[model samples]
Target: MTKHLSTPLANSMGIQDQVSFHRTELAIILSLYGRMVAAGEWRDYGISALKNLAVFSVYRRTAEVPMYRIEKRPKLRLQQGQYSVVGMDGKVLRRGRDLKQVLRVLERKLIRAVD
Candidate 1:
């Protein structure tokens, strides 16, 4: 029989040790989505929580690539800001400490003439 020095449970998240969204952050994101959805500008969305990042992707259609991505990287909380909105072109639309403000860049897309 072979003996291992470390236990199998050394690096893993248990069922209950999962990551979750902050209430304020969720409110900001969902509010934006709600407005976009009501305007028929967004059709679908997805969320991803990885080891070093949390991403919220917005889609114009179910089969196509996401139109936008809202990301949270805690590591950048001190450097270039933790929250960022990335466009479909993989460009950074905005980055800041406040989620609502960073998201304003996306809201700008919804603006149009009232004719």
Candidate 2:
């Protein structure tokens, strides 16, 4: 048996809303992070869960701005897909319904940085 925790949110519609990555999602992201770290392309990362979005920020160093941000916005799912990878310059590198596909953009960057 397993126990799961639930968090209550502040909202007026009498509806509960929680934005966060699932365990499997985190596993996938962490695997990429591990590879980038081993390749010496990434040093630090952060995760944030807001009312409408979940973000994974990657940084070269703790003090620097995130080099990339992977965002998930369920509101955008039907219209334009929920997964997006944004570069430091605030450009959308890729956006799609598949997280692994969107993350491939960063994999290319790792190759470039390593060489």
Best by TM-score: 1
Please state the error at residue 92 of candidate 2 in Å: 0.5
Model 2 clashing residue pairs (backbone):
none
lDDT of each: 0.87, 0.89
Q: Each candidate's TM vs. the true structure? A: 0.83, 0.82
Model 2 stretches with alpha carbons more than 4 Å out = 1-16, 112-115
Model 1 root mean square deviation, Cα atoms: 6.1
lDDT of 2 at 78: 94
As a whole number from 0 to 100, the lDDT of residue 92 in candidate 1 is 96
| lDDT, candidate 1, 13-98, per-residue tens | 44333244587898889998999999999989999887778899999999999999999988898998999999999999999988
Question: What does each candidate score in C-alpha RMSD?
Answer: 6.1, 5.6
Q: Which stretches of candidate 1 lie over 4 Å from their true place?
A: 1-20
Per-residue C-alpha lDDT of model 2 across residues 7-110, encoded as one tens digit per residue: 33434456666588989889889999999999899999999998899999999999999999999999998999999999999999999999899899888766
Q: How many backbone clashes does candidate 2 have?
A: 0
Q: What is the TM-score (0 to 1) of candidate 2?
A: 0.82
The candidate 2 region of ten consecutive residues with least summed lDDT is 4-13
Could you tell me the TM-score of candidate 1? 0.83
